[model samples]
Target chain A: MDHYTLLNPLIGGILIGLASLLATVLSGKIPGISGVFGRLLVLATPDPPSVAAATYGVAGKTWRAVFLLGLIGGAALSFALWQSAAIFRPMRPLVVMAIAGLLVGFGTRLGGGCTSGHGVCGVGIGAKDSMAATLIFMATAMVTVFIYNRAIL
Target chain B: MKAGKLFLLLVAGGLFGCGLAISGMTDPARVIGFLDLLGAWDPALLFVMAGAVAVYGLGMLVLRRFASRNLKLPTASSSPIDRRLVIGAAIFGLGWGLGGFCPGPALANLGGLRAEALLFVPAMAIGMLLAQRFFGADS
Candidate 1:
């Protein structure tokens, strides 16, 4: 764990927040990618709110497709840049990793928006729910880490 | 209008992804490893924030010139920063300190196809949903 590792959390947090704010100010969307995905998954149903009137009801299927595609495209672009420097570090046990993934997906649905939706977008505009969601989310995380290190580890 | 917004998002997303990658944020190992320092930690990530701010500031200035009076969004906003916020940021920080996965990176890492994030993300979502129901989401 050199320096870049630490930078990820703090700097990452700030950049993420900034990106979200800019996206909101410029595009009027909060950049809640996960929420976007959710709409995409459930787009089969007619969106209750009209697009112009509702602000963020259900987006068109085509737009969702493109949004999802942008996610992939962004990743690809980064991978292309970091292609060589990629450091495949030692991984947690596959079992552990898998469990973590399941937990995260479950948490996302339960939480409403992952960190981006609540923590960044929500917090940016001063949403009460985002704040509460982020608080509980963090508390649970802290307890889990403490347990993992002191007892589980 | 939707098309226009999508175009902007597409560009922003690309820039965001690039920022994460270039800032060395896409790699969780880097983050988890860094957390090894409970305190007396490096502020490298802070610099990343500064850089990103510079970029965002310039971007915002340019965007302001676009002269779009602005269309209202479906997304919710909270101006007061009430108890929920104080509590939420603390909780989010705790989770972040422990898991090294917050909102943006969680999504970006998912885009990178990291299997670990696959789990953390869902659990995170569930957590958010729980907040929405109990706390009453910003409808």
Candidate 2:
């Protein structure tokens, strides 16, 4: 705690806020990563025609794809510019990681949003559902971490 | 969509990724540390969320007044708190705690070429597909 610094996180958070703002203003879209990614998956895979229409339309696919590619490109650029921008530390085994991914994917879809969707953009707009979802997920995550630390670790 | 909108989307996505990287959210260890409430907790994430939410909240308020027509905002739903929301969030939280990665950070890490993300993203996609197919989850 003594060694913690606040400048970077603040700046980064502002950047994220600005990104969301831009997305909304320019494209009229909420930049929720899970929703964006999930819809893109629907487009790529052959699913029920109803599902495809219900989610992403043909016109919607290009922007989502470009946005995601930009996300990846931005991250790659950051890593290249700042070599220490990301340091990978494997906490759990590969199996655990895969399972975690599955849960995240399923849960976000089922729940209707992830941290970006609910936590940031949803909360930003003062949506009650987003607020409730955010609190529920945060509490559950904290409890899970507590159990993981005590029992798993 | 228009080329202009597409370009802006790209820029927005890039900014989002840069924010994640710069804020250290791309690191699962840092995320887990923040979540480890019982252990030595780091409040950096709180500040990040605060800063982001504050800006976004204000921005949306002003934007709605000026450009509501042009904006394709998410429609407000009338659904109440239900089992689907609770169960879904709980399941997502469990996975988040286990892996210490959310969708945003996980994808960003994949871009950074992290081996963990490589394994995680595919599984997440599969999970999303399953949820959509079997559970009729909304995308």
* Top-DockQ candidate index: 2
Give the alpha carbon lDDT tens digit for every residue of A1-153 in model 1: 232354444444454445555566654555566565544444223334555324333355555455446555665566665652133342355455544544454355445565556655565445677767766765566555545555655
Per-residue lDDT for B32-111 in model 2, tens only?
Answer: 88999978897767877888899998888887778648566654456576888888888899999899999988999878
Worst 10 residues of 1 chain B by lDDT: B33-42
What residue runs in model 1 are displaced by over 4 Å at the alpha carbon? A1-18, A25-27, A43-59, A83-91, B1-4, B33-68, B73-107, B110-139
Model 1 misses residue B45 by how many Å? 5.2
Docking quality level of the chain pair in candidate 1:
acceptable
DockQ of each: 0.27, 0.75
User: Candidate 1, residues B1-139: lDDT per residue as tens digits?
Assistant: 4678778667666656655655555565554444444533445454554554444444444555564656344345444545544555555555554556555556666666666566666665565555554554432
Q: Which residue runs of candidate 2 sit more than 4 Å off their true CA positions? A: A1-4, A43-55, B137-139
